[model samples]
Target: MIIPVDQLNPDTLNQVIREFLMRQGEDWGLAEGHLDDAIQQARDALVQGNLVLYWDENEESLTILSKEEVNQSGLG
Candidate 1:
């Protein structure tokens, strides 16, 4: 199911984004500053509709994914 980012509370939104970024490999590097930048980018994408929040029923998990990922996954 699609979830609007606005539906999440501020704290929950922050935690969800943080967890996703942490698992995103080395793309954002290890520096605190760079991590912030990466997080901002993701936030921008979400606001711009380039990325979206999804709730996967089977896994009972929430995830952030690119529009392409949603389309390719046949879930869009």
Candidate 2:
């Protein structure tokens, strides 16, 4: 299911973003010093609808994905 960005607590969302970024590592092409910038970008994408927050019931996990990525993957 897709959770709207505004619906999540700001602190929780921040932590989630941090975890996602750490997991992505170099895949996101983000340097260590640019973490704050990257997080802001991700937050902006979510608010602008360019990205989405997905909840997988079976996995009991939350993932952040681009709208195109979700649609193309048939997850949207």
> Number of clashing residue pairs in every model?
0, 0
Q: How far is 76's C-alpha from truth in model 1 (Å)?
A: 1.9
Q: In terms of lDDT, which candidate is strongest?
A: 2
Query: Per-prediction TM-score, please?
Result: 0.85, 0.87
Q: Write the per-residue lDDT of candidate 1 for residues 1-76, one digit (tens) a residue.
A: 8898899997898788788888883765635547777877778888888989899999999988889999999887
Query: Which stretches of model 2 miss by more than 4 angstroms?
Result: 27-29
Top candidate when judged by TM-score against the true structure: 2
Tens-place lDDT per residue, model 2, 5-76, is 988999999988888888875765576658888888888988999989999999999989889989999987
Against the reference, the lDDT scores of all candidates come to 0.83, 0.87
Please list the residue runs of candidate 1 whose C-alpha ends up more than 4 Å from where it truly belongs after superposition.
Answer: 29-33
